[model samples]
Target chain A: MACGRPKLRVGPSQREGGFTDSVPATVSRMENQSMRITALIVCLPLCAFGAATAQGLLLQRAGSQAENRPVIPKASKGDQCVADTEIMRKDHMSLLNHQRDETVIEGIRSEPYSLVSCVNCHAQTDTSGQAIRIDAEGQFCESCHSYAAVKIDCFTCHAAKPAAMEVIGNAEPHLMRDNPHTLVSYLLNKEANE
Target chain B: MSRVPVADNEKSLQARRRFLQGLGLAGMASMSYSLLEVKAKTPASSDKRWGLLIETEKCSSGCDACVRGCNEEHGIDDAGDDLTRAQWIRKIDLKDELTGNETSLPVMCQHCESAPCVDVCPTGASFKRADGVVLVNKHTCIGCRYCMMACPYKARSFIHETLTEQKPSAPRGKGTVESCTLCVHRIDEEQDRQPACAVKCTEEAHSAITFGDLNDPDSSISQKLNTLGGSQIRADLQLNTGVRYQGL
Candidate 1:
């Protein structure tokens, strides 16, 4: 007098034959949950490891190709720079921003850090010997900025190329001379000879 | 042989003494030169307040040499039509109300002591340098034309179109208000060099504009202003402009 179906009686030998009639329902449920937990624990680390290894390989492959990396131009003044390459590569924007304030606001137009000075040194020329614009592709500023996915708007208001000639009638006559440091050197040498 | 060594020692001692003396002299000279340089360059403490004295009597009725010079200096010759043109300086003709005679004079940013344009700028992009030269910092200018509206003389202009081939000394661009900077680049580089307009005027033999320090009594412009009593364009505003006009 079962509710729906009549229960068929099986021998005790058939208990391990994938029949859960003798096993407690609670024990079976717990076993299923434990199996799921074990699967997740085993699979999670394996998936993560796989993803990380794949990413590492991709990065290594990209790194091996020069085209994937940013091309920094050789400095006109050999390896001399206002700052160390590592520091400049990381924090150049901040330094330039601070320098802009100093030059524009305070009127401190010192060399090697000024925008004009940077253009004088870093501005590159094509085969025709004309200076390239700052925002041109493959140019010194654009190449690095584009590779880093940064947008630079400095060339919009600033001259992208170095001035062909220095502005006329500089206040310091010595500075205008062909050999600017000659006077200082001469003085030093005269002192040495004396 | 012993006497020869003695002589050599004496000679070396004399050379060392002379070297020390020369070093002392050079140090003194450099120290003095540096002191002079500081006095000359320091805008705050300097007794030289730069100004322009424009003798309207000498200004020709139709000549625009000053304006042309300014245009060439700033590379604004190609600035498009009348409305969008960057007019650093302009020649304006005025008819006398009583005399029925027409006179012309060059007008530009007066470089006021208490500039309203500087006051109204939200970002302080419009600023007066320590030398009293009013200039716009294009880096901070947000294309807000508050300075243009605030100017009493209508001296400022907003660049509407993109600029190209700008002079290296004058870095102007689109979306920024600009006005006469009194050739600040030249002033910074050369104390003796006049503003382009003044130079052009002299070259043309008009000699209408004279540029010199107002603070120094010995300066030619100061002497002329003191004796001739020049007038500011908007004297009612009490702006105390650096540029002054005579025979207006």
Candidate 2:
């Protein structure tokens, strides 16, 4: 844990405005006495109640914090995450946003930070053995996001689950340059015919 | 021509040397061709302009294979009535008034070189990829539907209802305008697959659709265009659509 330097508290004597020193000492002393008495009378019950409530909430939170921690689902494929847990927790959104632009506009799809990769590794399976969406309730992305109270708009426009295996693995025959009717073949055929 | 008379031994040696040189040249040429073929399989780049050639004359009326394939690939089911349903590709029948000649063709996003949808989008959501595939970035889409109004081909569709079970490759949602992506996901993938519509059409033996890189002069689609010629749907608009139609 990193420790922060303590901030200096500048009192009225140290302030650039020395107007407080111009007041009569007797008048200032009487005013300070009356203000202190009024504060004690007004804040006694409020501070006591506030402190009791805060203590109770803090105790409750401390006891349940471990139980309330997000239940991260086990990854389906990789033994380790693409990034450190701390780095990903803080910077995954920016990484995904940057990658999305690179892909959508520039047509550079080979980047490592793709949202599809996240879904592929994190999506969980239900009791029926069907793959559940990563953003579904109690799932990988949702469990943490709901605990943090941060609503994500990603799953709204993006898929929450990985694509079916066949969809990714099915390799159909390409019919472009390989076709016999291509320009080179067409020219060659024409020349042969001639 | 008179052959130069050299020693028999020297003549055989020269012949062997020539044979070795020819073999080396052949090997180099084959290696270069293989290298070029391997390079072509990489993801889309600015150097390539992917497009489709639709032979309308071969497209049979009432054939909805392309439409069905597109819907299935994108997981777009019947979320609403016909008027409200999102259609990425649709079959349209055309008839000439004077000659009474009938034609049928599949109409989708033209993927214009200077797309009006890209121009009209307020949020810069409707954008054309460097490889010429136009797509809607649903994350930034404000659902204004200005792209729908600006499109001359009426290709764009507005998603009105919240959607679920969208294909992982093709993510879509409510309150956004979308259109045909030309199977950009498939194009980006390292696998050897064409667009679903073109694949289905070829499987059905119609062979009416041809997807290829327009920038590659050696491509079959470019060769066909150079020889037979194709027409844009609205040529007067000067949009320079990537999708072309033959025998229109």
Candidate 3:
């Protein structure tokens, strides 16, 4: 779109080394053509990027004035004050996924519900306002076993699966980071004793 | 764009070829090796049909040794933001009927015979071995990510960035497509070296995610997958992915 000049009808002269006997007759016929098509393919995206950067500069200009103030600059995605919706969507998805991975990084809860030593899975409820049992229901451990009228064999070897550990819900002790195992030496001693 | 005469085009092509030759570049067996005229990297054929069968049940997810060890031996980056260093051996979780629980094991590129990634790639960067395995070249890849969409298992990732350090074993670059090579660099180069992932697994926990000839019944990988009733992921695609799953 940058091209406004009219096309030239004449090809380069014979003296021009870049062209010679190898030059096609069609090339002379199309001498007026600009490299618009080829350049446009690569340049359109770059122009959009430039437009975005310009918008960012404008927003930063107005926002710089306010001090200890919450600055809410009014601008659209196209105006470049913010990331385009598509980029924001991907970033948001990645962050949510990271949180999910982090919450489960400790793997599984090791202790029984009665022991507050393990905090990864089991937690306390707030209504009781004390360290209490959490109602974590996993479909794998609960649904089918109950349907078959079979008492779950899970407790024999393993405890119930953690339920929604990543979701920040209304449970109070679940929100707290208090720990039963205090010192590394104490943990080592406890492990050695067990 | 200026139109060139047929004769001129032919001259241009000849000049291009001569320029390439002068630059000390060699092309492949095919004519359109035109594109890779200077870098004839991929091997054409091996006169042998090689294949691998994976035993999923024998795999243990917590043991990252196979993943870590493979990365070390193959010179592959164990982890990275870009495809070049992304040699991820993922551990997938699934539910079970018998125990009604969470089961996990390592997963990787299936190296399908009728690979969809190869089919979809606009550029011929992703290719298959004369033997059954599939692979990709980092240099030629434009990072279009079409291969990612074509892969049924979602095994591929378009690495958008680079990492600080490079692995000496599996050399990698930035902004490309990469996946499990089944330790192809070792298989093709070294004199019969086992894949790093398989070698790293401790026998006591769950023997190495065994790989061997799929055709031979006596082969350990074959024996395990067949007898244990291991299954493949998204078999509906009928790519016949060489990799199989056990828990789910």
Predictions in order: chain A TM-score: 0.57, 0.59, 0.20
Give the worst 10-residue stretch by lDDT in candidate 1 chain B: B34-43
Candidate 1: lDDT of B84? 81
Chain A TM-score from candidate 2: 0.59
Candidate 3 lDDT over A109-161, as tens digits, reads: 22111111222223333465442222233232233234445574223211222
Q: In model 3, how large is the Cα lDDT of residue A114?
A: 18
Give the root-mean-square deviation of each candidate in angstroms: 17.7, 17.5, 25.6
Worst 10 residues of 1 chain A by lDDT: A177-186
> For residues B1-248, could you state the per-residue lDDT of candidate 1 as single tens digits?
23443344335534644564464356447533222222212222234567899999999888999998898788886445988878888789999789898879998999987677877778767876656677898898998999889888989888988877776678899999999988877766545778989988998999999998888898999899889899999898877899999998
Go through the candidates in order and give each one's C-alpha lDDT.
0.73, 0.77, 0.50
**What does the interface RMSD come to for each candidate?**
10.2, 11.6, 23.6
lDDT of 3: 0.50
Best by lDDT: 2
Model 1 CAPRI quality:
incorrect
Residue pairs clashing, model 1: none
Any idea what lDDT model 2 has? 0.77
